[model samples]
Target: MTEEIEAQSFEEEDVEFFEFKQFNKNALSVQLDTDTVYPEVIPPYPSLLAISNTYGYFVAATNEGFIYASTQDLHELFDNSEAGSKELLSQKIHFEISEGKVRCLRLSSDQLTLIVVVEGGLVLFYDVTKFASEKAGCQPFQIMTFPDDIRDLRPNPGEKYNLIAILLVSGIVYIKDYLLNNEISKIEGSKVGERFTAMCWSQKGKQIICGNHLGQLMQYTPEGTHKSSIQPPQELQQHYVQNVLWLESALFVVAYFPVIQEDDSELDVFIISRETKSKTLYIKSPTICSQISSDHPKLPYLYMETIKDWGPNLKCLIICASANSADINLIARDESNNWTSLNLSDTTRAALPLSEVNDEDTLPVGLALDFTCMESWITRLTADENTEVPPVPILYILNNECDIVAYRCFHKDAFFVDESFSGMSPPQKLPVTGHSSGMTLPKRDLSHSTTSTQNTTVLSAPIKTESPITDPIETGSPIVAPIKTASPVFAPIKTASPVVAPIKTASPVVAPIKTASPIIAPIKTASPMIVPTKSGISNNSLSSSISYDKNISSQKKIRTPPPDSTPSRNLGSNQPTEADSKTPHMIRMNATNNEINELHNLIEELENSYIAKYHDRTTEQCFDNPDAWLIGDLPVITSEINRLEHEASSMSQALADLRRQVNEFSHDVHIDYVKTTKDIEHLMYTPSTITVGRRGILQSRIKERLETTFKVGCYINFQRLFVYTNLYLCL
Candidate 1:
């Protein structure tokens, strides 16, 4: 390895490049009408799906499987309304279920009907408000069919909640939710008979799974009871179960994959057992290199992806939500790795001080689920905004040479970013914490599935292809939510490794990169190798590093910045000129590193975009230094700033070893204040007694004795005053 290139190299010293990049609010492109708003949305594809913001109108699914109902976040809520303000409506639905593109879309949490699952088969259902809000597409008011041709769809559990389940494609799986004979229900009967390729709904929903192809899973319960049957142990399900997830009740993780391939198809990860019929083991099947799934529920951290023995084939993605789900934030691509957030909770088996374990408080083994997909799985998980904690999870990962990342799994406590910056500072809008502790995520003893065998896991929808992203990494395993409490909760699926083939119905259809984009960035280095500060720099600044390797190797002096906009994207009149914007940035810098990893597959092309939406406080943009890694999911704050810089460097080295093991020192940590001198000769000889309230002292007990002797004004993390001074409460 005679290579130290340490003599010095970073040089792009032409700093004068700024004119239009100035509109930075972090990122906001907008622009939509993909044909009068979302007219069945289908402009391009390979994977970039999601829509259904529950009720205030919104719904979607497209890639040629067609379905749309909007109010904007559904991908077409335009506003030009003649200029006088408001307008976001988008509707297009006459119910077209030929099933070839659409991979997943569900909206039952009562916003009324809308489900579309086509990878090649079908499951279409739509209503978009049945008739008028001003009509958008309204048709098929209800059309159903599924014994096995679907491929992943979901909706079960609280909040306006409704009901939905399907994942067939010959892997046979179904759940329907209601309305049997006349439509909607498909008459139950399929339970474990085998054929499910992915399913999920075990956050305690009393049985709703299917994983088949023979590797098995097959649970059922809408009251027709069939609950029981799990496999994967005849040498890893022999192949099948593309994705399924659920993380905090126990285990039922599956990413499986082995139906046949030769050089790099090996993925694996399974932990199943929502009560009984077991399976366990994780993290050794070639040490997972990419993963994601925690679409936020407050930091349930999971993300890791790597590959770079030397260069060019580079590959990056790292973040497994650190800062106390214990150790995870390890990205690399030659940038080395580390950004630790270690403490894997188990407060003797976590009971919510909101515990998260794998190490902290030791006590291992709970909510277990062994995994396998030969290489990696789990590609999206998010939740965060103190909905109490479990919902701030963000994970999206994949790597062999492809990248898609987005990460951040909770870690704030400077009393939760100073009481959430004192109720969001200034004026006052407050109201954020509504408590969803979400089964506090870190508990797993495993045993579920026996309220007459009710286990669950489904992943459906598997049509992928939007590659062009950056950071995030590996599986954490715990998902168990439909929980009204029978315990059994294991469902995992965050996929990648698609090949499928066969589809050319003549070409010309394109849309699928609408939003959720960030392909993981804030790039990782969670371990060791990072070198490039351009190595060191000198030979007379190597002529400014050969003018930044000749401004990133001149395509005529690296200058193609225009076109952040001008409204010129024709795609076909055969328009894409300027030599098609210098060919995907020169085929994204000379392709191959597996097609320059499809220019960073941010889970199939920048799902809605991001640099940091971050949310809550309103505006705090900065980003530090990002050039690429944009595809949605990337916020495991360098293992939570390496767990608050290792607890502020172990609290400044335990206050400098407690002032060098002092012989005389006190431990009070003071901050007291009690001012009040209202004249009248100081209130007639200081006799001020105003205690007509609850016995005597209470203004939250003198602001907890002057904010615990003055540590007031700033705090949002000693676990939010551990119940106001360790649980004695105001007194």
Candidate 2:
């Protein structure tokens, strides 16, 4: 019965909890429906997106090769129109590309040039202003095509030169000067089966770091020579390098380790030091999605941006889409030099103003395919002086369903409000009457009607009334609305006035209370009790007497040493004093000194005995000339050294002969290996040398034997027939 009751209680709690959750979810949905505004201007099936920093406009490419650009700023484009309106659609300017489907769209660092990578390894460059113009059709000013399909292209970070790095479908990369239309150099993969998946140029465009499918990072100079290669750690050996980014002295590498179960795959980010060629930090995320059909499988998109003033050790923020889910992971380097992952959906739900839901299981499902950030939307002041405030960056994500979602990135303190006046009471609302006749009512003061409590003090002002207006039958008068006046600022409440005063008495004098002040007076007694003083004097005598005591009774007495005594020796001194001669401690010290002297004498006697027994020399002689002992064995030592040198020379000669023989043997082996390889190749290519089945060979041999047997039998039969005929003729 107890168990059943407990179960019933648990069920009741669960039901209540679920009902609360459902209500909150519904409220959140309604709030989102009212707050979120979807723009109709975004084209369907957005494949590539690029924002212009100079003009504050954005261009998006569809899967059908249609390019759409907003005529005005993207922020204004959505703000000026209502949801489901065709007005925004008309504001968008579009042009179709005949080249092919767009693969990538990038704006030059100067924000003046637009680089478009389309199908068939074609790179088209056009002016940003012209692409977004009101014209119906627009063409690229320059076009460069490669024999192989282009994988990725990056313009040099330096605005001085028009250099571009082009990665091809084959593992080859080309560094070309777009202005001159000439190839500067080409970089190829070092290993046979290695293919580059991602490539990024250094900040200064001095070096390029490329990640290959073999989970290795290769660094190359702009001059086309390989600089160095970094292999992934042992644990990440099975993972493929998908993306690589270079910042300062470290390389950020993104690797994907796919499992048999696609949902169990993980994405790893390695922060490798350039000088040490070792990993300084590593981060991993489970359930990172990848394109199975891609030759170099990778996430839908990976983006990175430097976070300014976030923290001393923050470094940068990495945003990438997670696999089999709609959320993106915000991986950042924390102060502890470790990566922390934050799901975008959870963050958004937690940051919602209407709902307090933060359950991970309730996260909305929508795969983030691509996202871009616009930093020029709004500027915010930082704490530093003499520095320009950077604009707040706004993130725009394109999900798998081709819907655009915008998120505003603001500082955590941006929404903070001052609550200094929050303790004050709010003003009361005024009562209103129903409007029946066309007559304006005069405004009256209601502050006099309200009364203050004993703890609070209220201040009243003179009441002012306005004249009422009357409407005639021909002239109509407008109904006057009540005007809300500002509430009077209330001062802090004062304490209540004193109720009683103490009576004056001669024996026990009472202190007079100030009537102007509201502080209560202290009580007085008829006869005062005395508080004993240290000198044992009464209060009346204390004022009259002026005698002073020569000495304080609280002072402690200290003894003074006689001047005749000699000054005591310093505690750290090693010399013995007169006092040390009379104590047992001095006797012990004398005994220790005597024992030490006896030990020294015994040690000298032992040494002398050892010298006399072993060397036939005095101890003094041994110490004075230590080399004398080695003089007798010098000739033996010299002979041993000579023998060792002879052996070493002979060994060296033998080693040289062995080395020569090994080289000859190796040469012969190489020749034999080459000859055998060629023979094997020849036999493999020759049709006649092909192997025949054993059954076929046996069948051919049997057929030959049967044919021979048949011929011989026929000859024997004819001979028998002739003999038979001759025998018959003779008869």
- What RMSD does each model have against the real structure? 33.9, 43.2
Model 1 RMSD in Å is 33.9
Report how far off residue 45 is in candidate 2 (Å): 15
Residue-level lDDT of model 2, residues 1-731, one tens digit each, is: 11111000001011110000111121222111121221222211122556543445556555454345542334444444444331223445555566566667776666566787766666666655554343546555555555556767878876534778887767678887654444567777765556776788888878888877777778887778888766665565556665566766464545444323263354555555443434233434443333333222333334444433342344455555432234444555546555555433332322212112222211111211111222233222345533222233444543322334444443333223211111112222211211111221111111211110011111121111121112111101111111111221111111121111112211211122222112222322322222222222111101012232547442222222342444344433334456766678555645544554465578679767754664544333553454664554434445657999999999999999999987885575456444433433443455365445533443344334334434544344234333433333222
Give the range where candidate 1 is weakest over 10 consecutive residues by summed lDDT: 364-373
lDDT of 1 by residue, 101-191 (tens): 4555555554355555554334445444443432444333223433233445676654424456654455534444322211123223354
lDDT score at residue 308, model 2, on the 0-100 scale:
34
> What residue runs in model 1 are displaced by over 4 Å at the alpha carbon?
1-126, 129-209, 212-215, 219-230, 233-676, 679-731
